[model samples]
Target: MLIGALLILTWLILLIRYPAKALPVSGAALIGLLLVGAWMYWLDTREARQLAHLELRLDYAPTRCPADRPLALTLKNGGGSPLQELRWRIAAYAPGDSVNLVETLYDAPRYRGPGELLPGDTWHDCLPLPPFRPGYRPDTLEFRAERLQGSFAD
Candidate 1:
């Protein structure tokens, strides 16, 4: 879909650039379309895998301060190549309500972290949750991971 769209767009641009006397319509447009399509297609990595193998748990559901309330998430990569970035959307469900948060690796690239999802690789992240109250007995804490667009192989 991406390549096809680019090809059509390029052809349109080339048609506008060519002069009336140059050709019947636009020869340059045809060439431009092919070139752009090839470039975009070249970026597709066929061997890439798309899936999330994650293990989330309340490491320490303390009824105290944020530092003391420990929430850890372990992500394991069971794919062929390394994932560029892993974005996580975590939701915590308590007795009668729930709250969700988006977590991403932070360090180098834009919204990317130092962690790379390598084959058979595991990354452990410690999330700080709002301190749980003593009176509230949480029902369940659930989490889902969303891999960034360019992170997965084509």
Candidate 2:
């Protein structure tokens, strides 16, 4: 935006100082801005496009230690590009409850997964879950992946 503002300001100054060169200069500046905008738009949408092809499966099991429940994550990258990073929200809900029992965000960089997930590959790992309320066992467990974000390999 600063660049754009500077470009416009320069164009205006050029127009007032020298009208002969203003048309050609403004044309070049307009083209440059269009190309830059298009490039930025493409870069912003690349991750979302790749994420559309990803499949995630979340499951959990009872552990002897209640506080140490481990969540099993199955990630399938069906996109044409390899994934560089991933983030998702995991929420645990009890049966017949509208609110979640526990919620956590899983960040690939922080958690350190099995490295970059390649295209057409499936990666499975057991991630540690945030502790739940003591002695609060639900009759049924629910797993849902929400607000998934990921970056594709260059």
Candidate 3:
């Protein structure tokens, strides 16, 4: 796209420098600009389609677990495109007092590999929970997928 713009700019400069050659230069510049616009539109549409077809499903096992037990989850791609990477945050919460404030036993984002995730692919692994001090019992698990990436053309 940048190259196309530079070429158009150079053509315009030449057109200004040579008034007699305006007709041919203008015709070529118009065609170049139209082709660039069409290419950009195609690229944009392809990206939108890819994003629309990308989906992720995270299934956590033993939502309530002892602090000593490892947290496990299965990540599945249930879409048409292959996923490149995914980042998410998981938190362990204890029972709240009067439903106003809950004790946070653990809270952090876990970074996962950019491994290829084809449609219907499932990746299972245990998440390393952060060490917690005493007086915290994990009663509930919270999960949020923060970012996602799909495959791109090289």
RMSD of each: 8.3, 4.6, 7.6
lDDT of each model, Cα atoms only?
0.50, 0.72, 0.57
Q: Which stretches of candidate 3 lie over 4 Å from their true place?
A: 1-17, 58-74, 81-114, 126-142, 152-154
Candidate 1: stretches off by over 4 Å: 1-27, 34-69, 91-114, 130-139, 147-154
- Between candidates 1 and 3, the one scoring higher on TM-score is 3
| Cα displacement (Å) at residue 22, model 1 | 4.7
List model 3 lDDT by residue over 79-147, tens digit each: 666777555444343334322122234353345644777777777665655433355433353433334
C-alpha RMSD between model 2 and the true structure: 4.6
Candidate 1 on 1-154: residue-level lDDT in tens? Answer: 9999997787667657765644554667568899999877765434222543333334433333255335555666666667666553434444344443322334312322325666677776555544333454333544333333436533
Better of 2 and 3 by TM-score: 2
> Candidate 3 — number of clashing residue pairs?
0
Cα shift from native, residue 54, model 1 (Å) = 7.8
Across residues 1-154, which tens digit of lDDT does each residue of candidate 2 receive?
9999997798788899998878787789789999999999998787678888999887774453244446777889999988888877666677677676663335422343345888889997776665454565543567667678777777
Best-performing candidate as measured by lDDT: 2
Q: List the residue pairs that clash in candidate 1.
A: 48-153, 105-113
